[model samples]
Target chain A: MRRFHISRLIMLVAVVAACSKKPPPAPPPAPAPAPTVNQDSIDAARRAAEAAATRAREAAAAAAAAAAAEASRMEAARADARRKLDAAVYFDYDMDEIRADQAATLDAKVPVLNANADIRLRISGHTDERGSDEYNIALGQRRAAAVRRYLVARGVSEARMEVESFGEQRPAMQGMDESAWSRNRRAEFTLTAGGNPIRVP
Target chain B: MIAGSFTRGQPRGLDDGRAVAVRSYSAALTSFWLVCVLWGLRPSVLPAQDPVASGVRIGLTYDRSGKPGVALTPVVGANADSVRLILGRDLDFSDRLTVIAPDSGDAPVGGLNYVLYARMNAVAVVQAAVTPSGGLHVSVHDVAGKRVISVIDVPLPEPALSPDWRHAVHVVSDSIELAVLGQRGISSSRVMFVRGNEIWSVDADGEGLRVVPGTVDGLSPAWSAAGNMIAYNTLPGAGGPSKIVVRDVLTGRSWSTRAAATNMNPAFSPDGGQLVFAAGTDGFDLYSVAPFTSDEPKRLTARKGSLNSSPTFSPDGRKIAYTSGILGHPEVYIVDADGSNADLLTSSGFGDQLYRSNPSWSPDGRLVAFQSRINGKFQLFTISVRDKSARQLTSEGENEDPSWAADGRHLVFVSTRTGTKQLWVMDMESSRARQLTHGGKVQNPAWSPRLDFSRQY
Candidate 1:
C-alpha cells in the first residue's frame, strides 16, 4: 500500500509537472490542466483524510475527560471517608462497654482505615459533668480504648490510633440529666497526621 | 446499669446546672420566734444539750486560755437590736458556747446587769459597746475569775465593714471565739466558689457576697495559702480546651498557663510556694508550677492512661492526695510530694469500685475528704491517712468538691440534696453540717486560710 501510494503520488506530480511546462506562451494563459486524474475521486479521498484526523482528535479528548472524572470521583470518596470517621461514638453510663448502637459508628470507620494506610486517628474519650472530673477522664479513656480495640479488631492498625481522655472536661451536650449525660459519655475520633477532618489535641 | 452521673452541655460547656441559689429561712425563723413570744413560752435558757440540730455540732470544749463555763451577752449599743442579733447569731453560729439573748435580760443596759450572766452559771461574759469613733469595742470577761480577758476594737470603714455592720460583727464574734477557745474560727475567712460563669465569694458570716471580677467562666477557684491569689481554670472558648490561670485575687493580675489544650484544677501547696494542677497534655495528670514564677511545671504523676486530678498537698507538704483511675475506676490516691509512693487510698474492694475523687487533705494531715458514689448518689467521705479507713460524712445529698478550713476539723463541700446545689460545711467529729450558701447551684468551695487574726483599722 505504501509503494502504491508513493507511485500514485509520483504519477500525479509528473502529470502536474508536464502540465505546468509553460507551453510556449501557455496558450494565451488558458486555465486548463485537467484530463490526467479523476477529479471527483480525488476530492472524495481528501475529505475522507480530513474526517479521519478530526475523529482521532476527538477520541484523544474523550479519553482525557474520562481519566479526569475518575480522579475526581476517587478524591470525593476519600473525602467522604474522612467525614464518616471524624465523629464520636457514645456509650452507656459507668459502662465502658460500647453499646450495639455505638458499634455502628465504629464500623463506619473500618473502610476509611483500610483504604487509606497513611491516615492515623486520634481518639479522645469524654464523659458527662456528673462524676468527679478525674474519674470521668479515666472512664473517658477506657471508652476511647474500647473503641480503639474494636477498630483494631476490624483490621485497623493499632499504631495509627492515639487515645486521650477529656473526661467531663469536654462535653458534647450541656445539662444534668440522662439525655445530656448519655451524649457526653463517648469516644470521639479525629484524623491526625493524614487526611483533613478535625484535629483535637 | 449504674445511672450516668455525668451531664453534658453544649456550646457553653458543662454548665452542670450549678447556678447558685441561696435562701436564709428568715420567714420561718421569724414565725417560730413570734410563736414563742406570743405564747409566753419562750425558753429563757439554752438547753444543756443544746439541740445542736441543722447539722451543727457545737463545741463546748473551751481551752484553759479562758475561764470555763463562760457566758456571753451582747450589750445593746447603738444598733441595739442589730448588735444583739449580729452578736447573738454569731454566738449561736460559733457552736462554741451558749449565747444569752439581750432582750431576755433587757431591764436596762446597766440595770439588767453583769451578775445575771454569772447567775446563769456563765463564767465568761462579752460586753459590746459602740465606741465614739463608730467602731465596736468588745471586752470579754472571765466572770468567775473576775478579770477581763481581751478587748477587740473593730474600726468601721466607709462601707462599714460590709453594710449594716454584718462583717464587723463577724470579726468581733470570731475574736470572741478565739479568746474563749484557742482555735481560730472560719467566720472571718471568705469562701470562693463557682456559681455559673462567675466565681462568687461570700463572707464567712454570710455578708459581703460578690463575684470575683476579671474572670471568664472560671471554675474550681483555689485560694492561695497567703490568701492573696486564686488559681482557677478558664475555658479556651466554645469547643476549645481549658487553661489554668492564677489571678491575684487582690490585684486582679493574670498569669496564663504555659501549656493549653487541657489544663485545670489548680491547687496551691500548703506553703503557697507551688501549685499543682491537672494537665491533659499526655493524659490527665498532676503537674506542679511555682506561683508567679517562670519555672516549668514538674510532673507529679506519670498516670498516662489513667486519669489523675484534684491534687492537694498535706499540711507538711510532704505528701499529696489526689484522684486517680488506675484500677479501671476512679479512687483517691496518695503519693509523696515528689510523685513517689503512689498508692490507692480508696479501695476498689468495695462494690464495683464506687467512684471516688476530689481529694482535699486536711491541714492536720490526718484526714482526707473526698466524694464517692453511694447508692447512686455522690456523698462526702473522709479517709484517714494513717488507717486508710473511710467514713461517709454526708448521706442526704450528692456532696462533692470538699475544701478544708484552717482548723482542719471543719470542711466545706457542695451538696445537691436540696434540689439546688449549695455550699455546706461539716464538722468531722460532731458530724454536724452547716449550709454555708443557699440559692443557685454552688460548686467548688475553697475556704481561705487564716488571713489575719484581727485588725483595728
Candidate 2:
C-alpha cells in the first residue's frame, strides 16, 4: 500500500511539473511501444490502488469497533461504581459511628462522588425494631448525618448530600433476631439527581 | 347497717347489727349537720374524712381499702342487652367499683330492692330504662340508705353498638361512677395508635376500633388536648423528607410542615394551639409550629450533634418533656416551652443501660412515663418530676411508648408480652394490665383526653 501511494505521488508531481512548464508543441509520435506492456502497467497500478483502498477501509472499521468497545467498557465501569455508591453501610445496635468494617465500603464511594460533582445523594438512616419509633428516627438521622460527615471529611461536597431518617419504619429485614436487626440498622444512599455516567477511580 | 371501720380515727361502734344501725342513724344526722357546716367553710379547712368529702352525706360510702360494690340491674327497653353489657364492662373496668351481675331472681320489680342489694353487700345499685325519646334513664340507688341518690338521662344515639351509642353508654357509666365514687370514669376517652402504617382510634374500653380517615403511612400519632386534632409523622417517599402532619380528625382538614427535612414525634400543646416535633438533618432538634397554620416553625432546641425527639407537653403546657441523646445515650429531658431551662429528667449512667425514650408527661404533671432499656429489652418506667425517683411498670416483655389516660391513673402502651406487639391498658394505681388490642403489631398508643361528644370541633 505504501509503494502504491508513493508511485501515485510521483506521478502527480510529474504531471504538475509538466503542466507548469510552457506547453511544448505537440511532440511527434514516437515509435509505438508494445500495446501489451502498456496494458500490463495500467492493470498493475489499478490493482495497487484497489488494494490500498481495501486496507484503509479495514483500518477505519477496526478503529470504529475499538471506540465502541471502549465506550461500553466505560459504561459498565460507571454502573459498577454506581452500585457501590448505592450500597448501604451497616451500624451496630443503637449506634451512629461508622464501623471499621464499613470504612472500605464507604471509602469506595468517595472517589466516585468526587469525580461526579453533579451527582446528588440522599442518605437515609435506619434502625432496628427495638427502640421507640421516634427515637429510632433520631438515631437514624444521626447515622445518616454521620455518613454525610464522613463523606464530607473525605473531600466530598456536603452540599451534594441530603440526610433523612426512616427510623425503624423501613426495615431492610424483618425478624426479631440480631440477623435482621443488624441489617436493618444501616445508612442507605440514593442518587437524587444528576445520574450521569460516572468515572470509576 | 353493717358496722365498718372508718378511715378517720373515729370511735369504734357496737358490733351488734341492730344496735349499730340505730347508732348509725344518729351518727348520720350528726354528719349531715357537720357537712352543712363544712360546706360553709373552705374545703381545705374540712377534715379529710368529712362526710361530704367522703360521699357519706350522700348516703353512699366505701372503705378506702376496698372498691365500692355496685350491682347492675338488667337494662330495660331498646338495645337493653348491649347497653347492659357495655355499662357492666365500663363499671368493672373503672377499677373504683366492683361490679356485680344481678341474678334473674335479683331483678327489680318496678323498683330497686335496696334491702336485697344491701344484703348482697352492694353499696350502690344502677338501674337503666330506655326512655321513649331514645335516651337512657339511669338511676343510681344508695342501697344503705334505700333511696335513689342520682338519676342521669343520657341520650343514646340511634343504631345499637355504634360508636356514638357506645360512647353515650360510657358517659352513663362515668356518671354512675361520679354518683358513687366521687370521681368520673375514663371510659369516655379514646386512644389513638399506629396499626400497620395507619392511625387508628379506639375507645378507652377497647371498643370502637377504627382507623382515622386519611391517615395512611403515619407514625407516632398523638391526640390533642381537646380530642379534636391529631398530630403524626408521615413516611417520606423516595428521596423525600419525612414530614409532620396535623389533622383535625373530625373535619378531616390536614396541615403539614413545609420544611424539607425529617420531621417526626409530633405532640400538640396542652392548649392545642401549637404542635411540637423533632425536625432536622443528621440529628433531630425540637421545633414548634402552629398546627393549624402554615406559618414557619420556631426552633426549640439547637443542640448540635445531639438528637432531640419524642416531645410531650406538660398538662399546663409550660414545660416539654422529650428524649435527648446529648449524653451519648438517649435520656428523657425536660425544657420549658419557650426553649429554656433544659435539664436532664432521667437518671443516667446506671451501669451503661442509659437508653430511655418516649417520655409521656402525666396529666397531673407529677410524673413522666418513659421506656428504658433493661437487660436487652425495653420496659415501662415512670419517673417522679419532683423527686426524680423512678418506678418500673413492666417486666414481662418489651414495652414502649406509654401515653397516659385522662384520669392519670392508667396508661396505654405497646407490649410484646403476648408474643405479638399489641396495645395494653394498665391501671397504674392497681398495677393491673389488660390487653386492649390483639392479633397485629400496633404501637405508639396515644390516649386522648376526656372527649365530649356533644361538642362539635
Proportion of native contacts present in model 2: 0.85
Cα error of candidate 1 at position B19, Å: 24
For model 1 chain B, the run of ten residues with the poorest summed lDDT: B1-10
Model 1 lDDT per residue over B170-219, tens place: 66777888887776566667788878777888765454567777665777
Give per-candidate clash totals: 24, 0
**In model 1, where do residues sit more than 4 Å from their true spots?**
A1-86, A95-125, A137-180, A187-201, B1-83, B104-112, B161-168, B236-240, B348-352, B453-457
All candidates: DockQ: 0.17, 0.52
Candidate 1 is graded, for docking, as: incorrect
TM per candidate, chain B: 0.80, 0.84
lDDT scores for all predictions?
A: 0.68, 0.79
